[model samples]
Target: MRLRIVVLFFVLAVGFVLAPRAAAQSPIVVVSQSLDMRFPRSMRFNIETKSNTRITVLRLTVWQNGVAVGARYSPAFAPSQHVRAGYNWSFQSLSEGGYLPPGTRGEYTWHIEDDAGNVHDTPRAAYAVEDRLHTWQTLSNDVVRVSWYEGDAAFGAAIFARALSAREFLAKQLNIQDIRPLQIFVYASKQDFFTALPPFSAEWTGGRMFPEYGVIMINFAPENSDWGMRATSHELSHAILHSKIRGTLGDLSVPHWLDEGLAVYNETSDHAPDDQFERMFQLAVLRNTLIPLRKLEQRFPADSEQAQLSYGESYSVVKFMIEKYGAEKFAALLNIYEKGAAPDDGLRQVYGMNQDELENAWRDEIGARSREISTARLPTLAPRPTFEVSSPLASPTVLPTASPAPTAEPTRIAQAANPAPDTAVPAPAPALPASGLCGGVVMLSGLVALSALKRRGGRDSER
Candidate 1:
């Protein structure tokens, strides 16, 4: 009987010791997780978890909102049974190559692991990295969305209508029907405009495009509707053209001339050249100071006059190609570039001539002398150039002028434009797995192309 009692007591002691161990082995439970998006500064992610054992690892995985892959971060936190982990994502001092644009929608998840080896993954949450300082209203169509904080509904509508027109025009011109959706954020003032862009942005930046993000930003009020429309169309052209040429394997390095030329040409709905741009081209032709198209294959010169002249020359060259060779052949040229053909190589395949020959052809058509060809060639992988298209303050008949009065809207303008959409809808922020341009899918490879436009004052625009 005594031996039986002793065995019972021993068994009870063993049960008491193992009970806690078994409880510790239970699965970890996430109590709560949230993201606080604070614009112009940082985003904060906080998560709380409960577990029987000490929480040893707390990881946060994030990617641009529609992207499949992302980077993982292990936040510093003390080990504890019930723990709260927080991480602050900063907006300051972004690397020139790996910066996220404002209005970038993102997704995040928490990876929690405990000392007992139990793991728990919280459901993914979505957030927008946007300017939260002001209230914003938006308008969207099937292909595009326009967001604004300062403008009235009419202002937003006008921008949205113009964006749609540009989209339709470019789609027809490029023979691209299945275009991804795009977002445009128009800031009413210059201070607000520069606030949204990267710190490295130049002072002359009037508008900017983040193609990988499907985003375009510009600073224009209702009174400057003509420039606003032109700038909007210009950036939209870049975004659309990029979508057509950005390949599954990698982005084809498009020649700066072709890229900016197409953008300037598309500033007007009818694809008419800007008068100021034409004048700049004519002036350069007379002075024999026209920068060779080969040199422009990589980037334009930094001098303000040279930059203006570069845009003018590019516009003239692209106009010549389309009017002479036909739009179908131009579309075919883009296809060749998408297949990874070199700049001159693609031109030759499409036009039966190389860069020099094409330049001579364009020159002859324009009544200008042929440019001298130098043997010097820029590196195959030249530093990505910033393209800046100039938006002269010329009002075209194609786009209606906005009401100069701060409070009143013209009956014609309001009637023609659509109202704001139901919500500030986000477009697909897809990142290529090959390059870390859109989001850091593999590594921080940054965007292959970051283009900007000069305001009316000729601030050195870098596209």
Candidate 2:
């Protein structure tokens, strides 16, 4: 009985240690779908394993329209660290027609087997084929064509399309027609994207017009977030502004302030106050720092603190101009610039005012508005004393009112009242003693000696 009890205890201990290992080695299956996945195009599916066991072979089977279209077994693959393995299965279009027929939809099953003969099958996954043409469409007028990718393509196309639309609207608003078309490229993944167009390292970049191809490359990879609406608008603004004015005006050479301001003005969205221009203006106003319009085009501080201020001031100045002078005048200025005229000259020609005068007007307008705001926000103060008081005098005697004593003169009473002036005479200027002179010389000699010693020490160290 004692031997049997010991044997039972040994068995229990072994099971306790091996149970977790067995569990950890068990197979696990997980599935995920892309946020922008659409039908009829190549969609990627990832199959993974959770066990440490190496998967020598795996098989994937896909079904569409109640029929198996793809059924293939993968060759042996080594299990990766973290005991997880992944396979990306892509479905291509069935025919060269580029459109999948209607009523074509079905599920897919992935069968995975590990080298240890552990079998795992995925829960049935489904997909449908739809008409590609109807899914993606673009609208074009006589001058420019605007199309977008909708199925599994990058979101940059939608952004670019919106930007073009905004440019067209603004151009018409400004009556500056003859806008040029911008061809936008949309990539599915960052890897595929950078493979085509090299990466850009700048924070915010513009003016990528290639003289050889007459095409501008405005990369949106860095700004490819859901919150990148303003960035998209900003880039598109550059494209439109250049296309419209550069050809006619011979390079427009507009100041950075005006350029950035116009871009920001066009970039405003209706969603939130955190949009580019508003945020910048509010920050500049709060921080009491604004970039002057004349110096806005040149390099200002690019630090986060200063950039925020710069953007705010630029937006405010542009908003002030538009609100005070009207959009027609602004548009006229653009037209003049497009005709190869200097900004100052263009302002004078179009608005009957030079650049300096316009800038001054804008500044004065902002100052007045700021003053009004300050006055409105001023704190209320307590009222002043109301009544005068009478003197507490008893008898009404005609006493002479002593004239106020003359302001007293400062006196050095501590020095002497009547002591001998000669004796008190400030001691003769202390004669420079020989010891003092010798002491000065000795100090100088010590400094010279220290300097020499330092020089010798430095030379010795060098040697």
Query: TM-score winner among the candidates?
Result: 1
Clashes of each: 5, 5
For each candidate, give its TM-score against the true structure: 0.74, 0.42
Off by over 4 Å in 2: 1-161, 187-193, 198-226, 248-250, 269-277, 367-463
The 0-to-1 C-alpha lDDT of every candidate, in the order given, reads 0.65, 0.42
Give one digit per residue, the lDDT tens place, for model 2 in 1-463. Answer: 9999999999999999999988765464443322123433434445555544665445444443311123333423565422333334322322211222222344555555566666666656665443243333444433333333333334544555566555554554555443433433332233332232212312222212221111222323323433234544554565556544543113434555676666666654431223333555665555655555555554345344455456556666667776777776777666556555665666677678654566666767766232212223334222222111111111212222332121121111122112221122212221111111111001121222322233223211100
lDDT of 1 by residue, 1-463 (tens): 9999999999999999999988755478888888887666777889988898899988776666423335455677899998988877766533211346676766677777788877776766777777777688988755687888886888888888888777765556555444566788888877787777665555655676666556777777776677678778888888767644653224536787898888888877777766555677899899877878888886666555666677889999999998998877787776666555788778877899888889989899988887777677735533222221111112211222331111111011111121122232222223321222211100011211221232333322223
RMSD of 2: 37.5
